[model samples]
Target: MIPPAALAIHLSIGQVYAFSVFNLPLSQIIGVTVSAPADWKLTTIGWIFSIAIVFLGLSAAVFGKWLERVGPRKAMFVAALCFSGGFFVSALGVHLHQIWIVYLGYGVLGGIGLGIGYISPVSTLIKWFPDRPGMATGMAIMGFGGGAMIGSPLAVALLDYFSSPISVGVSETFLVMGAIYFSLLMFGVVTVRIPPEGWKPENFVPSSKPGKLITSNHVDADTALKTPQFWLLWVILCVNVTAGIGVLGQASPMIQEMFEGVITAEAAAGFVGLLSLFNLIGRFFWSSLSDKIGRKTVYAIYFGLGLLMYALIPSLGRLDTAILFVIGFGIIMSMYGGGFATIPAYLRDLFGTYQVGAIHGRLLTAWSTAGILGPVLVNYIREIQINAGVDKAEAYTVTMYIMAGLLLIGLVCNYLVKEVDAKHQLFKEKKREGL
Candidate 1:
């Protein structure tokens, strides 16, 4: 029931990933079929998504402790309002042809919803399934990955239904989607529950001896910042995300450019959908696997295998093998999604469940950094290559190598992670004081 509740919120907020579907329509809002001289540039429109991501990180960090204190239900209620209201506001912006209104609505207000909704279920899910935190968090976060799968097609269908000679249908689409998402989120708010005091799964006992990296001691969110382990995990997440997000943003374009007429735009869209499917699957698969194999070991595989795949992508393009290229990227995207799902449990392991959600929220600032860094690295490097006389097909070659280098840095950071120092443990101090 809780998983379903979490899914309802995640699947709706996860629509952010499918926002590119709106880029073309929104760009042509005034022209209906093409860009008008007064219409927004694609580059300018790109900032909408960037602003939303930035705010997602900011709000998550800002509101995380509040969520922990107030509990997920109230937090989720607020998320539903902000998220749904953002859509309504953005719809008005579309209707009035006001870009700043759209930014204020979706980018700032809706992004607040995204952040709160994202972390709302994390601590609750962790508490509910203490014995298998990895699998529990994975189940809910997987919905976030799957949301784009549903959101993309749903938006396209709405646009087709509402499009007219005088309208691109974007404003109507925003209104409709807002209503739908709000209904979905309300279900989550009603269904989600926190565990009873001192609750544990039936017959599940605490481990007499925790694993070397697993802690029975708890660390508060503020103290987590002073620990090396937290920063290491932050680097690991940032690097992994930076490598994948850039490519995801460019997936449709990259496939077309790499295959050069061999793959049509329609085919490229299917490829993106396929990557989304893999992303959804990987979130569940890798994170659940982390339960058995240990979080640190699983992340090592992500960075290592990801490095190999990134290095191989350019070669696949050069070989003119679209299938192989798809396979490589599919695997990489899966690891990318897996990285997101696994990190919460990794935090639980190192910091204990005490304020883990808040810690996780603070950690997500890394994601905001990577969101800007990754796209810039990929887009700018590709442009530089092309301007320097490099062919379109090979323009991504240097970028791929650079991504592999980033993964290497991630691997080192993951290796540096160790048990949190004793001085940082809140429980240890309480015990020492005989509390």
Candidate 2:
């Protein structure tokens, strides 16, 4: 039941991933059928996504401690308000044809919803299933990965129902989506509950011996910032995210250009869909596996194998093997998603669950950093190579090599992670002293 509640929130907020569906329609809002002089440029519209991501990171880092203070119910309720309110505000902006209003609505207000909603259920799930933290977190986070699957189709359908001779129906679509998401999020708000103090599952005996990497002690989020392990994990997450996110943004274009005439736009879209499916499955599969194998080993596989997959994509393009190319990237995308799903449990293992949600929130700044870094690296480098006389098919070759280099750095970071120092366990002592 709690998992479903978490899913309701995650699946709704995950719609952020499918937001590209609105790009063309948004660009054509004034033109109705095509671009009009008054309509926004794609570049301008692109900033909406960037702003939302930036705010998501910022708000999460800022509000994480507050969420810990209030509990998931209140945090989720606020998330519902902000997220749904974002849609309502964006709808107004769309009707009025004001881009800045849309940015304020979806980018700022909605992103706050995203940040709070994203971390809301994570710590609760980790607490409820202490014996299997990775699997529990994976179950909920997997919904986030699969969210675009539901969101993209739903938005398109709504747009079709609402479109007309004069209207692209983006405003109408936003209104409907807002209502729907609010209802779904309220389910999470109503059902989410923290385990009673000192509660543990029946038959679950506490392990007297903690692993070297697994801490029985706690670290507050503020103090966790001062530890080396936190920064190391930050580097690991940023690099892994950077490697995958760059390719995700450019997946369709990259495949089309790599294969040229052999791959149709339709086939390229199918490729993107396939990658999304892999992303969804990998979120659950790898994280659940981590409960048995350990988080560090799973991340090691992500970076180690990721480096090989990225390095090979260029050659697959040169060899003109579309199937192998898709396979290679499918594997890469899975690891990308797996990296996200597994990290919360990794944090729990290192920092303990005392403020794991807040700590998790702080770590998402790495995602914010990667969101900007990944696209810039891929998009800018490709532009540079093209301007320097590189062929369309080969432009990504250099980019892939650079992505592989990032994975190498991530691998080193993952290997470097040992355990949090006991001195940082001062928070545990404070708890005993009733501080």
Candidate 3:
């Protein structure tokens, strides 16, 4: 029930990743007159998603402690309101043909919903299933990935139904999605509950590891920030996200350009959906594996194995084997999703559960940063090369190689991660003193 509540919230908020589905129609939306130039460009429209992501990081960082204090029910309710309201407001923005309004509505408001909603259920779930933290969180986070699977196609289908010669279809879709998400999230608010303080699941024996692989101590977000471990993990997340996001942001364009006539618009949408499915599956598969192999090893595979996979993508594209290319990227997408699901457990290992939610919130700043950097890098680099007369098929090669390099940096950061210092174990000391 708890996991499902979390999933209800996550599945709705996860629709943000599918925002790219609107990129084409939104950019070419017929405004005041069919003859008038488009009010927004692809680059300008890109900021809508970027701004929302920035707010997701910001709201999570700023309000994470508040979420802890208020608990999941209230937090999820607030998130539900803001997220659904953001869409309605954005719909108005579209009706009026005002980009700034859309930015304010969806980007800022919806983003706050995203951030709050994202972390709302994390800590509670961790507490409920201490013995299976990896699998527990993985189940909920998988919904985030799965949300995109549902959202991408759902948005496309809605657009087709609502769009006509007179309508661009974006505004109506926003209105509909907003209402649906609000209802689903409200259900989460109703269903979610916090366990009694100090409660542990029955038959679960706590690990008595000698070292810091698992800790009985807790660290607040502030102290966690003061440690080197947090920053290293932040770097790992940032670069890992950068590599995956670069591909996701440009999935449609990248595929069509690489394969041209071989890959149709429908096929590109299917490819995006395929990646989302893999993303959903990898969360459960990889994070559950972490229970046996440990979190650090899981991330090592994410970065090291990820590096080699990224390197293989460009060559696959050159070979013109669509199936092989999809398979390669599928592996990459799974690791991308795995990275998100595994990190909470990793945080538990390094920081303890005292303020793990807040710490996780602060750590999400890496995601906000990557959200902007990834798309900008891929799009900007490709644009420059195209202007230089590079072939469309070859434009992404440089981007792929750059992503591989970013993964290498992530590998280095992962290697540097160690347990937090004993000095930071204030909670452990407090427990000993019976304070």
Candidate 4:
């Protein structure tokens, strides 16, 4: 049985990815405390997001062993509280116009919730659907990628309803969002579960070592740190993310800029809606596809195709309704979400499930790095271009070119990867070897 509890974890953890919806609102409110939106710089707002992600990765890694020891049930119960509470407190912060409080509540506390909530489902799902680990994970992680699809539109509606001319009033919006998310997460906490021990699916046995793993068997956190494969995968993830998230972080503004006079404000919001829609759909679409093609090959396609698309963005140069930008960019955004959904299976394939949840946690540091690098790079490049008097349409041209180069480098890395050898599986040999 897949377990009802697992499903809830899927829904709850998935909400973390929806934070992008708050950017404009946060920017509007935060700009007051900091300065004007244009003067405040998106990079400054991006820092709050970066802080949360850094904590998200750190908590996940530091607590991976604790989660392994205690199991997801208790951990997730606490996650519901912290995650929900973070929103409520942030609501207070926003209302008060206290940027630090917003950072503390949403960035720090909510980030902890994000990290723990994110890993909450992996081990349980792995146990329940051992035969189809990739697909099983895809189901849960697919939600994470697509969360913004539902959240974006829903938030916009709520924002539209709640919003007044009073600088997007942080407090009331916080109260509303916090209440709903709190209730929803409570439902998830009630639903999550752990698998029966020593249970394996009928007629199922994982390959002694999957052919695609970077290193065979379970590498301890210590040994995993020492391996070349770990760093290679690390670099691969960094470049991969740097290519996509830079654009995604700027997605709303980017669309607005792309559409300019051609599309109205409502239409640009709709385009952001569409990008998120594609982002959500791609999560399920690409990760599910990876099950057939193998993760490495799927990632190879992500970067290989991503490079070409990014290069073309400069030439496309703001089309009618920004449709061209939307289509091209939306596809790559899905790859970003797909990367998160697929990596757990990738870790399982190489490092073995014996300690995969832990390994996956360590791997998340790459996301933390991306959280910082992506926004900074995008915002910094924009600042430079604006200062140099480049037109809005042309401002992002060099960034597209830089992202293209990054993806091509990632393409080479993905191609270079081969399965980890048995020799590397020396630690916990009995567990991974299944003796």
TM-score to true structure, per model: 0.96, 0.98, 0.92, 0.84
- Candidate 2 residue 205 Cα shift, in angstroms, is 2.1
lDDT of 3 by residue, 309-329 (tens): 888888888776689889889
- Candidate 2 contains a number of clashing pairs equal to 0
lDDT of 3: 0.88
The stretch of ten residues in a row with the least summed lDDT in candidate 2 is 426-435
Write one digit per residue (lDDT tens) for candidate 4, span 1-435. Answer: 344455455565555556666776777764544456443345555656666778889988887777877777677766777777777888887777677777888778878877887787787787677666777787777666655555556677777787766566556666776677667666666666666755777887756754545443466655666667677777788887887789876776776676577766787667666776676667667777776778888989888888889998877765554567777888888887777777787777666666677777788888888877887899999899989999887889999998988888888887776666566665554664533
Tens digit per residue, CA lDDT, model 1, 219-328: 98999999999999999999999999999989999999999979999999899899999999999999999999999999999999999999999889977569999999
Question: How would you encode candidate 2's per-residue C-alpha lDDT over 1-435 as one tens digit per residue?
Answer: 888999889999999999999999999999999999999999999988888889889888999989988999999999999999999999999999999999999999999999999999999999999989999999899988988999999999999999999999999999999999999999999999999755688999978986679988888898999999999999999999998999999999999998999999999999999999999889999999999989999999999999999988888997656999998999999999999999999999999988899999999999999999999999999999999999999999999999999999999999999999888875656765744
Please count the clashing residue pairs in each candidate, in the order shown: 0, 0, 0, 4
On TM-score, the candidate that comes out on top is 2
Off by over 4 Å in 1: 428-435
Model 1, CA-based lDDT: 0.92
Q: Which is the winner by TM-score between candidate 1 and candidate 4?
A: 1
At residue 80, candidate 2 shows an lDDT of 96
Clashes of 4: 4
Query: Which order, best to worst by TM-score?
Result: 2, 1, 3, 4
Q: Which prediction has more favorable TM-score, 1 or 2?
A: 2
Candidate 2 to truth, TM: 0.98
After TM-score superposition, the amount by which residue 101's alpha carbon in candidate 2 deviates from its true location, in angstroms, is 1.2
Model 2 alpha-carbon drift over 4 Å, by segment: 427-429, 432-434
